[model samples]
Target: MIRKINRIFQDYMREKRLKIGKNIWDRKNKEKIIEDNNFIEDNNIKSILFLRYDGKIGDMVINTIMFREIKKSYPEIKIGVVTRGGAKDIISNNKNVDKIYEYNKKTSEVKKLAREIALEKYDLLIDFSEMLRVNQMMFINMCKAKINIGINKKDWNLFEVSLKSIDYHYHISNLYLEILKFLGIKNIVRKYDLFPTNYMIEKLNLKNKKYVVFNPYAASKHRSFNLENMIKISEIILEKNFDKLILIGTKNHLSELERIKKRFGDKIIIPETENILEVVELISKANLVVTPDTSIVHIAATFERKMLCIYRREIGKEDKNSILWGPNYDQARVIYVDEKVKNGEEIDINKIKIEKLKEKIDEI
Candidate 1:
């Protein structure tokens, strides 16, 4: 009941704010002239700032991939990124990013951070955050960048250069690359390039096992897999001749890990730690990784580890090139669980086909 009410309230606020934002944008568009590609090239940008406010795992992955291509075009350019604290670990080691700025979404730190950004004197600012949040709009307007590029949303007139997608059906990596294309960056390369440290790899002692890692938790309940399904999947992995199974997440997932362990004691390894780099190192050594659509999956992609990614139907819209986003450098496969109903009721675990899952496991 509480979840239903929260969803209703959230939808109401979204619609209300979107209406107001559209009206503001319409008024602004009538007065300002939209610039063209010629104007962008004339600006001569030397430094670029990328912003990812939504801070989802996919968005960070797209950002990291796009930044690599952007760096290749302008090797001498300085690139910076601003994201939430949760994504700090993913973006911290990104080669294209010279500096990383983190901000709390709930506090005034966003505004304070924006102020500092306004003083950076950047040549271009790219807002990869698709949402039209008021604070982000304010920050984009304040930045000293000569060329500002972003999505052509209802409030797109506020940006000097913009690219519009047909709908939300487009892949996020392509969407980000579209903005780069608008800025005259044409040599596009789509691949995940995250380099893990030797220190991180050494700490996990990952060389000894033919193992697969599983991360069944997500920040939002709506995106998480049912614990029962997670347990069944773990059991299938153990039965399929795998040596070990590592479960990684925060302490909140300990109960679920314990539940899995109870069924297959000592075979399931759940390491408790607040350090994300350690988790990355552990994931790097895995022979295969089974995870929900989360940041850990992005880390696994960096190491080119074979992956069995289970994505919810609703969130699957964001995964445009499903196979491309998988372990691109090595063996990987993506299994999308479409909406399935049983006995006139929406069943969560039933959405994933166990037989198809086993077939994919056998292929890997």
Candidate 2:
């Protein structure tokens, strides 16, 4: 099958890239590999830079705790973040971040950004990349910070303070906080903070009407609820304790959302908006948030909004996805489609029971 061939090709490319990366890193930093965990412990840090170039909104939302807590604990330490795309938007309003450097996958751009970072001469640099890709290693090596910290990997001799990987299942946000814990930042608060924008404030005008946000789409189709199930869920929510149902998704989902819009007409409210922050603002003020496995879950968790999330897991098997990246806030409920799935197959989220979903809506 095409999928199997693509997987094989991807694996081949990954191994090839890893071999090339190790060769390049060995030649580039032959005499620069240092291991000193005590450098940060001895109060010798003044400035810190974090590499968060992965452009997922949920991942960036989780990283918010790092920026805020570090600034809170060490008021004098200058904080800088390297990010791109939508990930940049999440922290654009963060007060704790003193500077942000943007970079992309292009070698020229990354090299230029690395040179710029080296000029800053940060006392500490942190790389949270679990996979030590060639470009990531190239950028990290080029940064030339005094002390580099990151999650430990087996044979990669890149970071100076390589903290051991977290062994137990914890919310990813808390797992990231372990880096701060290693740096002696004890006054950590396990919560998320999002700044309100004038654009978001001006755009949201529900006028005190109670509304629930229903996001039935995900980045991948398999993770999204099917149209039939979406309608059923919408009907269930509307019949329960909500005044209006606000349907939301990205521009790519407009046609499908429009189709759903035709079914309910005036009862369903779809706000015209631009950008993810607007969607975040929409979730912020909602009465309750209902979504599939998507970044909306994280946005809802940020505000501790009452949330009902849907996901799929193989029956009688340990669901690692839910265990690692489920909603972190209280007042959150998740409905998992527990059915047997064969190997190399994606679980169908539409298989979730409508009765169970309705039960959750009533409880919320």
TM-score of 1: 0.81
For candidate 1, give the lDDT of residue 263. 82
| Per-residue lDDT of model 1, residues 1-364, tens digit only | 8987998899999888876755554222222333466333456667888877666655676577667877887788888887775567766776788988886674377668877887887877777555766656666665555566666554466666566742445444566666667666776777666655556434445466688888877666655777777877887888877777888778877887788888888877887655576677777788888876677767787777888886655342444444444344456687777764443343253368888888899898
| Worst lDDT 10-window in candidate 1 | 25-34
Query: What TM-score does each of the candidates earn?
Result: 0.81, 0.92
**How many residue-pair clashes does candidate 1 contain?**
0
- Candidate 1 regions exceeding 4 Å error are 1-41, 166-170, 314-330, 340-347
Inter-residue clash pairs, candidate 2: none
**Highest-TM-score candidate:** 2
Distance from true location, Cα of 185 in model 2, Å: 0.7
User: lDDT of each model, Cα atoms only?
Assistant: 0.69, 0.80
10 residues in a row with least lDDT, candidate 2: 26-35
